[model samples]
Target: MKKMNIKKILVGTAAGAVMLGSMAIPVLAAKPANDVLVKNWFVYNRSSDFAKLWDDNKATVLDNGGVGFTFNNVGATTWYTAYLKAHYNGDLTGKTITANVSVTEDNATFVTRGDGSTSTVGIVIKSAEGNWGVNDYWWPTNRQLLSALGTDVDIIASTSDSNRANWINICGLPATDATIHSGPDCVGGTYPAESPYDGFTNALKNVKEVGLSFGGSGYARGVALTGGTASFQLNSFTVAE
Candidate 1:
């Protein structure tokens, strides 16, 4: 009976240890279901005030090439910018992503400064920035989109200028949303009527997220005062998932 009692006590202790260990394992290894997932779109439209600065640079960037404009006093200068707010379901810290930006302008103009007399002479994505600038004329000084994503503007093609008839496609992951601006006014003096692309799209390849900036600056590029005059429009934007 004494031996049987000792054996029974040992068995009970072993069972208790096993049960405790099982409970602790789950507590230590379990993770919440909402730990990883991102969902949110940061979109900016031409209508948004972000495009205001483009109006100033219209002269040098766009109109400088001898484009036409509705606002005569609008020198050949225009400035344009964009912003996006994406809701990463999870933490976006240390994630690699690629964004494809498409821009179109209507009734726009262009002035070829460098490489004088080039077919497609117009504003290029100087760099992507996180925040909006004071006006389209001023370049974004903080949190540059290119510096963040570690890439530069990759211009696939550009069609038309100084009118609503130009198309631009670029690929890269800006550290954050992109603020694209262009104008022809490096020589000072204010220009007005900076128009943005009719539509804009932002895509994150790593997480598979896409956002459309339609109503505000819409997902469109802006027009400058370069020359030429016509209603600028952006075609539907497409991105590979």
Candidate 2:
């Protein structure tokens, strides 16, 4: 509900990639590691606030030593992988993705990035503009990620130092193309949905910028303190064959 005083803004690219500044990002010819998925990223709070970044409080590290994300309600974060640029716009057709999310009882009631409050975990695929597959959970009711989900069960939540809300990615994208979103309106179906190759299918094939969304409905920061500070973390995210 609260907005942040952002200093930096993410610059969109023709390839649907996002850089820290408005400048163009150079092309990369790197490849994935043996045991890891990605090594580079375009990490930022959805708010693009640099207040936290001015200091040494950067985001956490991914499993393969890549960049991950961290933020509060006023500084919710998103980590868009640069694998597309590095690999000439790669496609995640048959690969499986796995990751862990850290949630707190204080954030159980807070809905995640989506429309109106129909928050869910979004695994977006894009190129200039694209679609996403989601796991739309009923806030305060859905306990798939965190036990909180507005239910306040706090059964299997996560913390700053730990991540328990794991995800296997099971959701669907919109019927059209998009880069930014308020949130999802429909229930989750299947990620990287197969078919017509005009919506989700298209985005997955020409993947330019894939987003790992875990912020509040409108980039609300913090994940604890009952929404005082929207601190959240995603860890060990990996895509493998």
Candidate 3:
């Protein structure tokens, strides 16, 4: 793996001081009121007000240019999802997003004792058709990393107006599973509807937010992780072109 040089930029705000990292350049002045790309990132731990987790010390900035979190006793009814939205008001048509993501189980209990179908970690891109009424989402399929020792993958998504969105797996080894196979080769199905936004490309055309998410529906089906820890990391997320 190549070494990543991530810079941390701290700015003062009415709420206090905020830390922004991995930006192209550091802004020494006061923070802007609307920094869609860097600010307003919150962790949703099975609740609508997941943003509160930021202040609770649940999310932390890793030393290696990434964000990390630990979940304990998380049930099927609840999961973790984190996102950062762009502050711009224009459409994201013809744009692409890329990132290096990794997820690992600190212990083997979940793999050895569980059915191996109960966990998932992935990248998600969300977009709204118009002003922000209904939204659509795109992400990688669970089979892409279900049975692997951990996740270390590079994912790319390109957007278009129609169902022309594309998700490519640049490199990395992902585990495969037999069940939950209903979508593209490595990409997952689009949410709400699958007809027009069958692939990730169409969903990306109007992207409003993007981020990483961990958790699966397998727990609801009786598969549980009684012991072990899982960590999800995003080295960086940037506009591809």
Q: Pick the candidate with the highest TM-score.
A: 3
In Å, residue 178's CA in model 2 sits off its true spot by: 17
**Top lDDT hit:** 3
Total clashing residue pairs per candidate?
A: 81, 25, 2
lDDT of 2 by residue, 56-120 (tens): 22343332232323233322542211111112256544444334343323333443432334334
Candidate 3 deviant stretches above 4 angstroms:
1-39, 47-58, 75-90, 108-117, 129-135, 140-143, 146-152, 160-205, 215-225
**Best first by TM-score, ranked:** 3, 2, 1
Worst 10 residues of 2 by lDDT: 6-15
Model 1: per-residue Cα lDDT at residue 197: 34
* TM-score per candidate, chains pooled: 0.22, 0.39, 0.49
In model 3, how many backbone clashes occur? 2
| lDDT of the candidates, in the order given | 0.22, 0.31, 0.39
Question: Model 2 segments beyond 4 Å from truth?
Answer: 1-39, 47-58, 62-69, 74-88, 104-119, 129-196, 215-230
| Residue 50 local lDDT, model 1 | 38
The lDDT of model 1 is 0.22
